[model samples]
Target: MIAVLRTPRFLLRQPQLGDAELIARYLNDYDVAGNLARVPYPYHLSDAKAWLRTRVPGLPVEETNFSIELAGEGFAGHVGFHRGPQGPIIGYWLGKPFWGRGIMSEAVEASLDWFFSASAAPVVYSGVFHFNAASLAIQTKLGFTETGRSTLLCLARGAELEHIDTQLTRSVWKARHT
Candidate 1:
């Protein structure tokens, strides 16, 4: 277990095996599956088991996967900051049941704060698909600026021809937090 990252109505923390069932629900949603290249539409229990084995939660928030918890529920969605040699990347998805509720935004803010405060990475980049307005809005709300665009041949869903690159730098994060 890790120290919790608290928001007014949510808690961002390391994930556990118990969260697999709920996380499967979120990953099975096309809205989430389509944008992310790794998720398969028909997410399965085995997939969840493999995910748990990846040990995303046991590592630092800046280097591992984490869960979005909504008070009573243990996990609402998946949100995490992953580190690379260059910097960190943002990856997240909310259960369809929890969409349209501003929950993801709060979770993103909390995660970004954790990343900037804890890691050596100077920035965090998020791959926001052009059609995903909610996700783009979430990035903007967190002060991520439009950096550029990318085209990925997603293994799960073929080519995503309209992916936009968005990023938030340490300087920008510091400016906003101050």
Candidate 2:
């Protein structure tokens, strides 16, 4: 599929109706599902469709929830932003098999670049389960700094959680201008 922005190895695009199974297989892994708050443990096709159907309030469907697609090695992961009280909240996840391959970092950098370009705001933010070293490393590689923290109450996981809050600012991006 044609994406709004295609990185050298990944494609940042809108979610398609038929991507249910593709989304489920990667996310349903217990190792993978534990890191994110929203994705269910079972990760059914219906769950994928329900998520895809969630549109931003008062905004059209196209403006929200962009999915990151990896085409070369397969559709390996997803990246997207959602509305937050402070600003836009960026999120992403790659299947465990794709970990350590530098795939998610490429996708995240591309997503941050796009977010900075599209918004008047000068920064992008991400949060991760503090224990997710891989995600923290990927965010660091993409120029995000650990600037804050929060607790996420995961009903599915059935616990209070501590998460690392990371941010990439326009100033940082400008400082590293390519």
TM-score of every candidate relative to the true structure: 0.90, 0.86
Candidate 2 local lDDT, 1-178, one digit each (tens)? 2237787877777776666677888787878888887776877778877776764244422244556666766567788877667677788888788888887778777766766776777777777888889888888877789888899865447677998888878898878777
Please report the candidate that would top TM-score against the real structure.
1
Over the stretch 21-89, how does candidate 1's per-residue lDDT look in tens digits? 887777876767887866776788788878887874457656666688888766788887666445778
Residue pairs of candidate 2 with colliding backbone atoms: none
Q: Candidate 2's error at 15, in angstroms?
A: 0.8
List runs of model 1 lying over 4 Å from the truth: 56-61
Instruction: Report residue 165 deviation for candidate 2 (angstroms).
Output: 1.7
